[model samples]
Target: MLSIIVALLVNLLIETSVSFSVVVPGDPVVAHVGSTVILPCWINPPENAEALEIRWYRKEFSNTFLHYKPGKVPDMPVEPYRNRTSLTPRSDQSGGLKDGDVSLRLEKLRVQDEGSFRCYVSGESSYDSEEVDLKVTALGSTPVLFLKFLDDGRVNISCKSSGWHPKPSVTWMSDERRVLHPGGVFYSREAHEMFSVHSWTAVSRSDAQLVSCSLSLKTGELKDGRMDIQGIVSSDSSGPWKALFFTLFIFALLGFGLVGFFLYKCRPGKKPDKEIVGDVNIEEPRKHAVEITVDREHLHPDLMVTKNCKIMRDGPGYDHTGEGFPYELCAFGAQRFTSGRHYWEVKLTQENTPPKNYWLIGVVKHGNFTVRDRSALTPSSGYWFLCSDGPNGFHTNTDPPVKLSLTPRPERLGVLLDYEEGQLSFYNIKESKHLLTISTRFSGTVVPLFNPGAGDQSPLIILDCTKPVKSAEESSQPLLSNNSSNA
Candidate 1:
């Protein structure tokens, strides 16, 4: 009887030891937004957990997310995790519930999901709980570099990017890996709780031509952009000649204006014809026509781009493919404009398809083109667009969205980007009308934007705007200027 009692005591001690301890990953599990992850948790001795009560909670035991027990249906998870939570094996090697793998499988992970999760398991007489750390991250858009000529002859190079979670570190370095001192750094929290960062540094002509800016996250995701200051910096040497020519050209223009004004006055009551003036204003954008093609690398996965990258349409798949622009339903232009004027046109109507009633046309800072929501596409966020809501009306994403009444809806839209002049003008090419002009100080490289709204039957076609430019001798009259808006 003494030997049997001793054997029973040993068995109980072994069973208690096997069930009293829980094992979890020592390192924090890292996941990005919109992804799925498994927080590894299991019994130390690998005993079956099917009959044991399992609870996955955060912060404390009462704040449970998932609960399960033997011979009873599992209770509903908390509201935020209604259908996005589940139980699964820690990995392929895990033996699953039969062998005590009670890892929590989280789906559709969000920024708010970053924290500590407690994995608690209990039997009739023994229980164990362990904490697993989770880290959420979001890799934001590429950094965009903007160059501004400071009054003191140094060039102010600004770097900006958006949509990053857990603010990333910005680094400005020369091609030789030398660190640079930034003039200013600004960070703004977007509507979606992501971070947008902008930093600037001034460089002189004597500095190296290649300057690169990088944004890095703790999870090892990094984005970088570079700018060549050779062209801009070298132009400084010709400043005197450029100024002299500019002064002479201005005097010549004044002389011509005076002569034209006197000649018009001499021809008493000879007013300009409205038709001719309208035609000239409408054709002004064509003078700066440039060839533009869609950028496949920056395009949304839901968009099907042609081989030539000139046409784009919505694809059948609505789910993101984890490539290209993860959230934006738009495509970027391959051509980038840092200065001077440029114009391109997009065709909204395709043969055998319904006319496109919904579209978004505009320009965005190069490298800062990805956007998750329309509300974040404001000018302050480095987005300037004209949205057409399919029979609802036309609007601009200004501080307070401006609504415009457009008649005889445009089939082909012309976009004119006057970078140095700080103007973005839209035109109705078919109707020979100047639609609207948005004025804002443009910094950095800007790229054309196009969005064929979902459910639209037609695709957006980028036409080759390489038409011949008109010369001064061919002009019959000066172009009429459109009023500029704060947009």
Candidate 2:
């Protein structure tokens, strides 16, 4: 009887000595925006955790990001994490909890997603928790330089870049390697918590030649852009004006000779059937081109915009409604138009293996526009869309919807809106063929809208058509109004 009691007591002691603890990564996990990363957390001894309750939450929040109660399904995660957070399986054949792996797989990481997360595991008799830190970074676009003439005979050089996380440092330098002190600096934070910066400096015309702008981060990522201002100034006190005059004289003689030849070709009976104007043979569409940039603040959470605001693509995770539109990947233009003619182009590519199955591009009114309902896309509802579906082909979003028959589908689409004329037209820029036109009276302000559609990896790019004019006469030529309102 004494030996039996002693053996039972030893067994009890063995059972009591079994330990329960949590293991987490010693270092913080670093991930880029629009990428997937794993936050590791697991039971130290590798026991079956399938029956244990597992909960993951942000260290600063009470709302759980993920919660699993043994045999029951997980509860809904917080808004920002919906459809973006999941648990990795410990093995291919068994559920993750069975092997004590509670690692969280987060997709389409955003700048605001950086922080510490707590993973809690609870069993019938033991409970343990661990904290893991995640850091998110975004590389910004290449810097761009803009030049403006100031009233004091100096030029204002502005350098701009977007889509950086934790901000970045910008510098201006002259061709002679002199560092410049920027007059002003500005920063804006996007909805994703990334940043955009603009810095400006005033320099004399002589010092403006070959100005360079550079943006850099602590991680050794750097981008540089340069602008040549020599052409902007005709001559400086130390420059050779006589040589410039001689060059102009030679060009003038050549221009006169070309004009004479053109006149000789059109002389009386020798006139050709088609008239030639300048170097172009065809009458191009009225040039009303505008530079379009995506509005980051209004972008869908599951959509990623390039630092330049020109390219937009569907993010990695499945789509879920945290706020605003529920099932669509949408972004708006940064500029809005209330009047006058405006035109912009979007380029699509077949480089994506299967190509994108669905896309929508057009304009939408500013107020009371709900992107929540895909069916509400119509002119009456303040939306004018030219949509394409893989199976359904192309169509316009009208009251009854109009099916479009287009041969050799367009890869580059040009949208022309004439607010005063009550006209909206679509064109295949590659073929220079007009596709469709809708006549509708628009009121108030309207901004460009873009949707790349779900499951499509292809990005929609806004093409920049603005270029520097060579002569003052060309620069002064009357073109479409370039004024725009903030989107």
Candidate 3:
């Protein structure tokens, strides 16, 4: 007749210094009120089950209390366990039925325990072993934090305490040990492998000369760590402010002198101080063409038509293109030529028809002309363009050098000979603006004319073309296109 037993589920074991084992009945059991408890138990093979005997006991006056055999413990109380103890088997859970887990349990444990208890589960002629110990915790106190600075201007605050089942955490107070508004504080734990309690703090100096570090720990214990930290309190070095001050002082003196001079000259009572106008600040040297000797008596008819004479077929040297229209000025005649002033006439026509295209000339940067868009003019200091003669002058004709001319007249345009800038432009003298500029070569060889008829077609013509340079002011503007060289 198999019986079933059931009782406390908490297991207790016999404790050795390093390990504990489940108590088998009949063994002396020792227990500490606040220490852990373990129940010794193990599994028995089905064939080994019947012979087992399990018992529960206590050492009040030193003796066994109850005996467990199969489904029931015998009818004896053994005194100390008269009502305080009971041992029963679980049919549903015999000792180690699954894998030799003969687990047992205990209740209302007290200290002063110092012996082995047992659950004797004997197999049909043998038994196996399993056990556990019961331990109680009495953590009784909280941890605290302390603050201090090291000798080398470092912080040496520490946190510590005892009376904890596991250590407790201690964090530094902000206001000298009390909580304060925005005091940056740090934390660390108690120095224990149990990971119980901890404490921490941040140490900083009173001024910019101070260095700070944060202590982190679980036990809030003390240990040496790198003093190096993240927050920077101050800098140790100074800069060159003194040098800069001296330099600026000298500059102020010079500026003061100038201001004083101005105030004295233009005082309210002084009728706006005045001085004779100085020479004009011209970009180029003034000296206009002093004197000019015409190579031919009769100029190119084309030069006469629009009065764009005062020119020569430039370049046969450093002139590269052998092309540019090198206009020479009749410093005196330029002003009157456009207004239709009369001039003495000499004659010398080209020995042969001076070709269809030749240079026509006009003043560029002076007289009636000026470099309106600096981008269109080179900054060669002495550089200038020939103003335009009328278009009909040299662009087209039966005899270009003769059909249209550059001598005298009003509009702007003339045979494009060559130039330094990439493209050459023709201007309308009468209209006072650029007519158009031509690109790409019209013909290979350009001819010259000593004197050609005037008043037929274009005026100022470019002989060789080169890229135009942008003046400082023009360079600041946005570019139009990659190919565009001038405004």
Which candidate leads the pack in lDDT? 1
Predicted structure with the largest TM-score when compared to the true one: 1
Better of 2 and 3 by lDDT: 2
Taking all chains together, each candidate's TM-score versus the true structure is 0.56, 0.49, 0.22
Candidate 2 lDDT over 1-487, as tens digits, reads 9999999999998897676898898988888889988898889788888778888897643768899897697888879899999989634554577678888999888888898999898887789888999888788877767666677989887787667887888888888899989898777664456776778888997656788888887777778889887765644443466556534433322233344345546568765532211222112443788889887666676676666677766676645433333325667888999999888878775453444556789888764223656654656546787887766677677644666666666777778888997778777766766666666789778999888765554566677756532223122222221112122
Task: Residues 1-487, candidate 3: write the lDDT tens digits.
Answer: 1222222222222111122233343443444234434454544223333335655444332354555566664667655446545432434545443344444445444432334554445544344443333333224223333344456764444333322332232333343334312233322222121222323444555521222222333434332222222123232123266446434433322233344344445557665432111122111111211222232222321122212233333211212232332232112222221121111111111223222233333222222121122222321111223322234344311110113233333222322223332233333332332333333222121222222223212222221112222223122223212111221
Candidate 3 regions with alpha-carbon error over 4 angstroms: 1-40, 47-51, 56-66, 70-101, 108-119, 127-142, 148-158, 165-487
In candidate 1 the C-alpha lDDT for residue 331 amounts to: 83
Q: What residue runs in model 1 are displaced by over 4 Å at the alpha carbon?
A: 1-18, 235-380, 385-487
> What are the Cα lDDT values of the candidates?
0.77, 0.71, 0.31
Residue 447: error of model 2 in Å? 5.2
Query: What local lDDT does model 3 show for residue 229?
Result: 24
Model 1 Cα lDDT, one tens digit per residue, 320-419: 4433322378789889899999999887775566567778899998876556766557685677878787767788887556676676778888898989
Q: Estimate the overall C-alpha local distance difference test score of candidate 2.
A: 0.71
Q: Give lDDT: candidate 1, residue 165.
A: 91
Task: Please state the error at residue 399 of candidate 3 in Å.
Answer: 99
